[model samples]
Target: MYNSDSFYLIASWRKEECPLKLSELQSKFGWLLIPAAVLVLVAFYFLNPQEKPEENLQASLDLIQAEPPQQTETPTQNPAPTTLMVDIKGQVAKPGVYELPVDSRMTDAIDAAGGFLAAAEPKAINLAMKVVDEMVIYVPEIGEEAALPTAQPGAAAAGGAKEALVNLNTATDVELMTLPGIGPSKAEAIIAYRTDSGSFQKIEDLKNVTGIGDKTFEKLKDSITVN
Candidate 1:
């Protein structure tokens, strides 16, 4: 029985429905669920762990473990045993080309020249001087003017004319008896001396023997080798 012009329903009374509150507003986030699922699928697609290249890794390890090649050296060739060619000049009786063993010294070259001509200044030449291939050895004699022997007027270029060698280790009773300035008894004395001491380590050791003098030692030095 309200005013007839008022907006009202004239009917039997019925309960009215209330509007939704804060809890119901949560339903709007439901739309975001589909995109969140997509992001998760993409993340795993890119970030999943991968297997390393094991074969390549193993090859590197094998290289490190392998041993290096062993080095080998080849022996050098022995130089052909050479004869020293020496032309003896000056006071020597026979001043000619002499074929001397390698390592020959000045004094040996003089011997090839036929020992000093009595008046030679024996002390003038240093016999211990080292000689080389094709070297000329000179001996100045003191008194008599003897003509030095030259290559025979027409002799072939003698590859080497004469050869001589003295052993440092084993010259015997008569062997020691022949050195210049040495006599048989003195030779015996030399043998005794060498036998008493050990084998000669150097030709210089001969000086220690009673009979060996500066001239003698000088004369022998080039003609001998410890080996």
Candidate 2:
């Protein structure tokens, strides 16, 4: 209810005031800046290009599922089949009747007897030979030694010196090498003679072999057998 003059004066003062109104500007824009900053941050979080969470999630799932299976240890197995006893005799360092387990061969018998003497021919015995219960195995001396190396797995320890020898009648080439003066070639000749002719009927009959002579016969007669 100002008087007309006062009202006019008041209106004119307002018009002559500074062009910029600081209070009104501050009031209107101050509230707007805060809301705008909040909106910008929210938009940036949602639309960021560097975000790839699905692959990271899948990798995490793969790591969890890729664990390997648990291990289980196995026990060792025992050998099968049974064993038996046999006699071993020969030029082996230790000759005796061995209580060997079977599925055994002649070589096994020799091994049980502590192997051969230095002069004992390795080729003298048939190693692939199979073992038999109570079978006689004979190992002969390599040379003219009295305490002869010969053995007949059974009747051996006290046998006569002559009995400690080979039986041309029943020997293989491997066993023939056990003779005092025989070797591979000479043994082969004896074998050939045996195959060509029948068994030697007597000591004199061995002379029919090409390699045999009076001297050779003397060396072989006692050692060779007819049966």
Candidate 3:
């Protein structure tokens, strides 16, 4: 029932309005897509399981504390006591060699030798003197003359007869020369040795002299004594 002009106007208006509405809907849908993408990323991050750095460190510390402590070892000490050999002779109930501690005194030696006899002279020797290795101790009889040079008793004479032994410490050079294997030169050497090195502490000490060796000491050992 309308004319050609009115129909053309209505078609043009509809075409323009349809294009504007489509553009507005596309802009709105693009904004919604951005928010939806952010939500998906957040969900993926929380879904995967992983240990925290602080938790891993604390677990390592706990494992170390659970182990047992180490034990420290203490060192052991076992020390042996020192000992010495002593010879006790003359006037005692028993006369023999005995083993004694290094700190043992003369009284201890007398006790080891069955104590002194009734005729023993205690004041003749120093009872408080510390005993030495291979030392000789002699207890003289009461009223007997104190032996010259030392408190120790004399050794038996070299001959078959039993006579008072020669005192090496007090004997003259001529007397020393009288012994076997000793000559004037050897006597002089012995006198010089005793003069330089005090009185001999033991018969073995004679071996320390010049020109005297183990073989020479072997021959003289039985003929000498040191108190």
Candidate 4:
């Protein structure tokens, strides 16, 4: 009975003392806890580094630089057409050599030569034929003998009139070779003579060629013309 009273008193005293001690401790240390918590948050903020503005910009630039540039296809161009020289002679309005595109036809050459004249025998020549370099396009007149042997006087009578005759001034080597007794050498000789002496004024000028004697001239006399 006596011990119960003592124990109750002691318990009451200890409870009051504990509350006083706890209040004092809280008053003294509560402000310190808040500051310590703030310090810990500040240290954490400093330790966890944030990205720099320059670093972010550099990263963006690097990313852009890492990518390949877009490729563009280049357009192809067509090759230019080749040009060639051709001669247009005889009955054409403008008879001379003309520059033309490769694969150009005889009609093109004739057109470049100012077209054919009224007396031009268009049927006597191949107008659709392609013109070549150093080519000669001769447009003979109607009723002109292209190739005839003067030795045969009856043949001219039989034919009524002379057909289209080869123009000596404008005849090509191939065309001159078609004459009687005229080969490649003789045709070249005729071209050489014409080139050196200019246009022959008369049919007798044919004898002036090296190989063409009186017999050769007689064989080609009536068959040839100057105009």
Task: Give the distance in Å from residue 44's predicted Cα in candidate 4 to where it truly belongs.
Answer: 37
Candidate 2 per-residue C-alpha lDDT over 1-227 given as tens digits, one digit per residue, 9 for 90 to 100: 78999999988888788555788788868888888999999999888866479988998999988988678988978976467555545467886778777677877877888987886756545677666555445555555222222445542221112234567778777566555455667778888987889776776887787766786566556556777
**What tens-digit string does per-residue lDDT give for candidate 1 at 1-227?**
46754434332222123244446655857677799999998998789955568977997889977968678998998898778677665457786788999887777888877877765666656677656565545454453212121232222111111124346578655444333334466667767887788788887888888857786566446445556
lDDT of each: 0.58, 0.63, 0.65, 0.68
Best candidate per TM-score, number? 3
TM-scores, each model vs. reference: 0.33, 0.31, 0.36, 0.35
Clashes in each model (backbone N, CA, C under 3 Å)?
Answer: 1, 2, 0, 7
Give the Å error, residue 91, model 3. Answer: 2.5
Q: Where is the poorest 10-residue window by lDDT in model 1?
A: 154-163
**What stretches of model 4 exceed 4 Å from their correct place?**
1-81, 147-227
lDDT per residue for candidate 4 within 1-227, as digits (tens), equals 55888999999999987766767888878889988999999999999989999999999999999999999998989987599776565678997779998898877888999998999777766666655665545565665544322212222111111223657888777656556446578888999999999999988888889978996665445446789
Candidate 3 lDDT, tens digit per residue, 4-69?
A: 998999998888767667578878677888889999988888997679999999999999999888
Q: Which candidate is the best by lDDT?
A: 4
Q: What is the Cα-based lDDT of residue 128 in candidate 4?
A: 66
